[model samples]
Target: MNVSEYLLKRLKEWGLHRVYGYPGDGIGGIDLALQKAVDRGDLEYVQVRHEEMAAFMASAHAKFTGQPGLCIATSGPGAIHLLNGLYDAKMDHVGVVAIMGQQASTCIGANYQQEVDLQSLCKDLANDYVVTVSNPYQIRHAIDRAVRIARDKHVPTVVIIPNDVQIKPFKEAPNAHGFTHTGIGETTFAHVTDVAGLHEAARILNEGERVAILAGAGALNATEALLTVAETLGAGIAKALLGKAAVPDHYPFVTGSMGLLGTKPSWDMMKECDTLLMVGSAFPYSEFLPDPGKAKGVQIDIEPANMSLRYPMDVCLQGDSASVLKALLPLLKPKSNRKWRKKIENNVASWWQLLESRAMQEATPLNPQRVFWELSPRLPDNAIITADSGSVANWYARDLKFRAGMKGSLSGGLASLGAGTPYAISAKMAYPERTVIACMGDGAMQMNGINEMITISKYWKNWSNPRLIVLVLNNEDLNQVTWEERAQSGAGKTEVTQSIPDFPFAKYAELLGLRGIFVNTPDRLGAAWDEALNADRPVILEAKTDPNVPPLPPHITLAQAKAFMTSLIDEPERASTMVNSARQVLASFLPRRRD
Candidate 1:
């Protein structure tokens, strides 16, 4: 046995069925090992153009499969290219293992070709990393530890294999036991014993007339538990964008999301609630939170550090949402509070009506709001939407209503740019039957969009099937940033100079052998969307939008306002335009009482 063979066998024992990455000279031995493993029915290698896309695919696989997904990369630039996606996986708490080939141990510090310190470079991007030594005896244990840390910590892990060591002849030892140990189950429920805190939380819930629940991504696995809890308390449920999949949109208790890009009903319900229960979410916007002095609040999270960090809490229970909810369910008395439920439902209905009315009445050349409305109906029931970080995210976050059966994914906490295309590609690969669409701004499209087209092409060539739609909102500038800049500078005074070249994004899609459509009007949007959705391969819809459009997050604090004002003093006119746009957009969402 060689080092590569031993490594491959260990991965197989750990139930790894697939690996994603691009092969290079440094990793040639490992690549051959993987190919041999595939021939032996142990693993399958998915060849991608960019190492970052491989990481992204692995992250999405882990997210969907609830296991540690694997990716491989060669030394130097190949390994470094995976940093962005690895960071995203870390931030999102996805379990993934990245294996990178390194320069031979002999030339590690000699500046040999493609020589780099992968362990040092990936330290911050991964929760745990180990550089494999030449001795094959330590391979099993190192891999076992890496897997355990990656899974238990809910973060990425990296393992570096030296080129020379991988191809070296080695013998399998008699006692080649792998790492499969689990932590003591007793420690898992330690946080549930806070009797005093639990009692206080129960008291608040019992006394409050209006209770609201805010769900986060951490509650995804415990969706049934959360729904049961919401129903027991007759509470209205509001979720962060990351929590979209946790509670289906059709759930009667759901009142949509909360924050800068939140729904009107969700925001209104939060404001009116006498008690707010935050479940597995560290929603960052303080302004959207209930007034601490007036409304009592309780937070349940697996991570203790997440509780009471964004907003003050009356009760903070550091326990898994499933475990905490299970314990709390027995203690909770069923409430028949129809008043609170009715109020939330009415607000949500009104908000939906307003949005529909606006979409129907809009007659602009390229009404983004209208385009979203048209596309929403045509989207598949199991469709997954990946929104880029910018104005497009804001639009989708604020207005794109997920149908009852649809599911979606987006970067919520550290919302990074250039994630849309890769996310969509990965989502499509993870669930072939589902329609995967990436909605991004023109600027964001230029960031990581090109590489993913190749990913789609490769997948299409192999599988003869691909269902990805890259919808580019070609506004020709960083609309969100420019709007904020202008808002601070009072509009006219702020000279927004940035402009994106009119790249043939649609033509690029055609060159990749995918359908391409360039749209500049609302009427053409529906047809374009239909054509793209019906295509066998991937498609890119480049919709030219108004560059002046701005994205305002759901909540902006007084401190943020002060900063904006300070920045605005330098460009008064631009600042005024931003303020005006914000005022108008907000006015449209705010509740109105007809006289």
Candidate 2:
């Protein structure tokens, strides 16, 4: 057996049957091994446009499957391209493995062409574990340990394989017996609940009124328990962006999302709440939280380092979310006061009304919000939605509310662009039977997704009529950055740097031999969505949307308003944009100060 073959065999045994990467000459041996494995049906190698997309796809696959995702890249530029996607996995706390090629060991310090000090480059970004496999005997131990660390710790690990070492002949492969594999049946398991911690958390809940529940991705496993906690405490549940799936949007007393891309009821709850009970989410934005002294907090997390990292905690309950909540439910006393819940409920209802008005309004060009509004109802019950980062994310986070069975994901903490299409493709590949939709913007789609269309075209015949849609919001502007500049810098006019030339994306999809639909008016949006949903193969729907629409923060500050007004003097054509901001601010029920 050769070293490359042995490494591939070990990865297959670890349950990584699919690998995403763009091949290069440096990893010739490993590439040859992957081709043989694909022929045997032991693995599938996805050829993506850029190496970055490959890493992003691997990250998304792991997040969706709850298993470690694997992506391969050759030496130098290919390896460097993997950093952003790997960082996405590390920041979001998902398991992904990156197998990178290295220059031959013969030229250690010679600084060969495309040679980079990978160990030093990746140590800080891929912090969980980063090592190079230098010897034949070290192959099994290094690859096995990398997979194990990624799965157990839920962090990405990079394995650098030297070119000359990969082609080296070996008489025998290392045994897997001595290694600790974390497979379901082979791994030891236990349910841990902190008895004392739960008691203290309940005590804190009982003593406080106007309680608010903050949930994040950690709460995904304990939805029923989380709801029970919210109901017992008479608290409104607010989800962090990554935790949007923790509870159904229609659930009573559940404020949609928190922070800039948040619901009005959530903003109100944070400002007025007396006690905050956070679960599974280490939400980073502390400014959106209630003042420290105004509210006492109880946080539940499996990782001790995550507890109290974002907000002050009165009781830190360090344990699994589901187990701790199940044990804590019995100790809690239900609140008799419905006043707090009622007030928040009314705010949530009012917020929805405002959203409906903005989304359905008639305009010369289509309102971007309407696209999501019409698409939401058309979504399959088991659909997987992937959103890109930018102005579109605002509508995606606010407009698209999935039911219990639906799944959604994005580059959360990394907040990286160009991952939307890859994430959607990975979801479709992982769950071939379910529908997958990518809500991408023009800038993000053009960045790394334009040529990625070739991937869908080349591989479409393998699926059982997979339902995959790439809905491009073609506003011809980097709308999110433009909005940020306006909101933060008091710049009322859209800067020339943020503008992009419009492209016929629907026609671009046609050139790829996929179904394409173009909609310039709001009236045509419904039909385009329907056609895309029912298509036999992959479909792309491109809409000419309005770029002037701003994704305003939940609560507009006096300073932001002042800066906005000051900057508007530079351009007289921004009156409509100013009015839209005012409407969004008013919808949140901003209180007026008394003189």
Candidate 3:
């Protein structure tokens, strides 16, 4: 067998069945081998429109499947295109293996075309491991180490294969001075917190009058344990954006996402709490958390380096979130006074009501919040949701309610704009029987979503349950940055830089032979969602939303208020912006009027 064939066979042995990539001449050997692997039913290849989308799909595959996702790319430009998506995986701490092609080995140092130093390019993304195979025997150990390191470290790893070496005959490393042998197996982690550390954590949690729990992406698998612990302590739980699915939003004391896009109950709970229990999350914004020394903190994390990085914890336990919480449960005493939990539940109920009122407020055509608000109740069970970063994320974070058995994620750490479509596609690929939805702004759709529709057209017929839905908020503006300029930077919206050309997203989907539904009014949103969810094939549900409606923070500070007022002096849409902003702020205090 050739080296390229051996690599595919070895990946099959590692139990990886899928690969996402785009082909190029530099990687011709592997491209040829992929057909043979597919013929043998050993591996399936998904051809994406761009190498960057391939990397994003791989990252999403890892997030959805709990396995190391694999992506392949050709030399120079193709390899460079994988950087943004790979960085997204690195920042979110997901397992991914990127195989990149390089120029022929003999052409090294000759300045051959497409000969760039890939090792330096991938250094930061694959900090722990990045290797290039120079010999046929080196391929074995290189592939083994890349998969193992990525899976164990939960970070992206790189394996570079030269074009010349990829076609050479495979050979086992013999018993020689310079040869190394490797075996394939899964690494088991025995991660449990010590008894003393558990006791200390329990002690702090037991002493507090009011307790608040914060969870992140790392806590996704610890839902049952998290719920139990929150019940035992009578604590309210707050999720970071990436941990939207860590616990069900229907719980009485489960406050939704926390930070700029957070809910008011989360802000109130953190501000009033005396004890903080943070699990499997390093939610970067310290300002959103309690003031230092106001609340005693206890943290649990699998990575030793992230134990107390976010907050000054009294006891830092390094272990898996579920196991640590289970061990600490025996030591924790159940709180009999339900006062704290009751207060939290009341706040949460009020917050939800306020959100509904805001979503129902009038806009030019439709309020973006109403789109997500209407879809929240109509979501299918066991559905997977993905969102792009923009003003759309404001509605996604605050309005959509996630129930148990549902999965959701976004570009959390990197906060990239073009990930929603690829992520939803990957989710559908991984779970064909379950429905998948992608929520995007017009900016993200134009950036990458429009091209990826062809990918959907290619693969939708192969899926068992073809219920993939793409929702586009067509506001014709880069809404998030425009609001940031007004609210945070004290500058008016610059139409030259923020305005984006409008496109008929639903019409484009229909042209691709998929279902399309467009809604310009709030009254039609619920029916549009029902139609999209029940469609026989994939559908694009586009909503024409107002761009002037402000995305208000849970708590607006005096400085932010001053900046927003200053911005209105030169703001192009000052009148509409002022009217909408006032309507949103007043909606919180007044109850919704019957239509």
Candidate 4:
């Protein structure tokens, strides 16, 4: 047995059936070995165009499958390019194993071409980093440890393998069993000593004042428990975008998401609530938080570091959400405050009404909000939506409603651009029967979208389902950056540098042997969307949009507004044009009733 064969066997033991990556010289020997394994029907390699895309795809696969996804990259630049995607996986808490190829072992100190200290570079981002020793006997143990760290900690781990080691003959080690698979432990209850704190929280709830529950990604594993708590406490629930899978939108307590792109009702509920209970959520946006001086806040989290990190809590309970809720329920007295519940419920109803009204009145050049509204109803019940980091993210995070059993995933904290395409592809691969759509902006699509199309063509050609559909809003500029610049300097200039040069998106999709459609009006959008959803293969719907429109951030300072205005003050004509364009867009969406 050779070192490569031993490594492959260990990966098989780790339950990795597919590996995502591109071939490079540093890993050329291992690649050949993998090919040999493929020929022997021992493994399958899913090739990707770029290492970054490979990492993104692997992250999404790991997140959905609840297993460590593997990504391979060659030495030097290949390993370096994997950082952004790995960081995203780390922040998102998706278990991943990045197998990076290294230069020959003898070239370590010579500064050889494509030689990089990959182990050091990935140290902070990964939970574990191991450089394979030249001795083939150590290969199995190193691979085993890397897999264990990724699976147990729910974080990325790196294992750097030298090119020369691939050909070395494997020597049998005494303890070849490697690591054991461990399942998540059963939930355990924790003792709550804060009797006074529990009473105080119950009193606020029983008083009939508005109350809202905010959930985050941490609550995903405890969705049932969180939902039970919401019902028992009679508190309306609003999830952060990262926590979309925590509860379905159809749930009675579900108001919407809370953030910049969050729903108005969710934001309004946060404001109106005299008492707020944050359950496993560390929503980074302070604007959505209750002012500490005015309203009382209660937080239940497993991580102590997350507590008081965003909003200072009046009552902080450190325990798993399920454990904490079970403990707290028994200590608290049930409240029959119909008025308080009704007040918050009415606010949610009003908010939904406003959303519907807005959607009905929206017209011309097709409002992105209206498009989302139309698309949401048409989506399959088990659809999985993946959003890229850009203006579209803000809209989807707030507006898109998930049907029962439907799931959504996005790059939230590490919010890097160009995740949508790869994420969608991976989601489809993970759940082939479910509808998977990549909602992205033109700016973001240009970043990493094109590569995944090729990946699908190469690997999943015979899969007769249109598992991935990309909805590209082609506004022709980096709208988010342009908005930030305008907001800061009042300059109405569309930063040409951010613009993707001459992107023939539809033509490109067609060239890849995928269906491509260009939509201009609402009618065209509806028809094209319907076609894409039902297509037998992947499709891309490129919609030309108003570039001047901007997705507002959750919180912006008055000082920031002043700076933006200052930029506009110098160029009155350009600023006036921008303002008029915005007004027209708004006017087109304003509510109107036929006489």
Best by TM-score: 3
lDDT of model number 2: 0.85
lDDT of 2 at 409: 86
Q: Candidate 1 lDDT (Cα, whole model)?
A: 0.75
Please, what is the TM-score per model?
0.88, 0.95, 0.99, 0.88
Among residues 3 or more apart in sequence or in different chains, the pairs in candidate 2 whose N, CA or C atoms overlap within 3 Å are none
**Residue runs of model 4 more than 4 Å from their true location after superposition:** 40-42, 127-132, 175-209, 314-332, 357-364, 552-595
lDDT of 3 by residue, 1-595 (tens): 9999999999989988899999987788899899999999999899999999999999999998889999999998999999999999999999899999999999977899999899998998999999989899999999998998898899999999999899999998899998888889977777656787788888999999899999998899999999999999999999999999999999999999999999999999999999999999989998888999999999988888887787888999988888888898989899999999999999998888899999999998999999998999999999999999988888889999999999999899999999999999999999999999999999999999999999999999999999999999999999999999999999999999999998999999999999989999888999999999999999999999999999999899999999999999999999889999999999988957445
Model 2 ranges off by over 4 Å: 170-191, 572-576, 579-595
Better of 3 and 4 by lDDT: 3
lDDT of 4: 0.75
How well does candidate 1 match the true structure in TM-score terms? Answer: 0.88
Q: For candidate 4, lDDT tens digit of each residue in 280-357?
A: 776888977777656777888866767877887778877667667666776554556656566667766555554554
Supply the TM-score for candidate 3.
0.99
lDDT for each residue of candidate 2 in 3-84, tens digit (9 for 90 to 100): 9998898888988899999888768899999999999999989999889999999999988888899999999999999999
Q: Sort by TM-score, best first.
A: 3, 2, 4, 1
> Model 2 TM-score?
0.95
lDDT of 1 at 27: 86
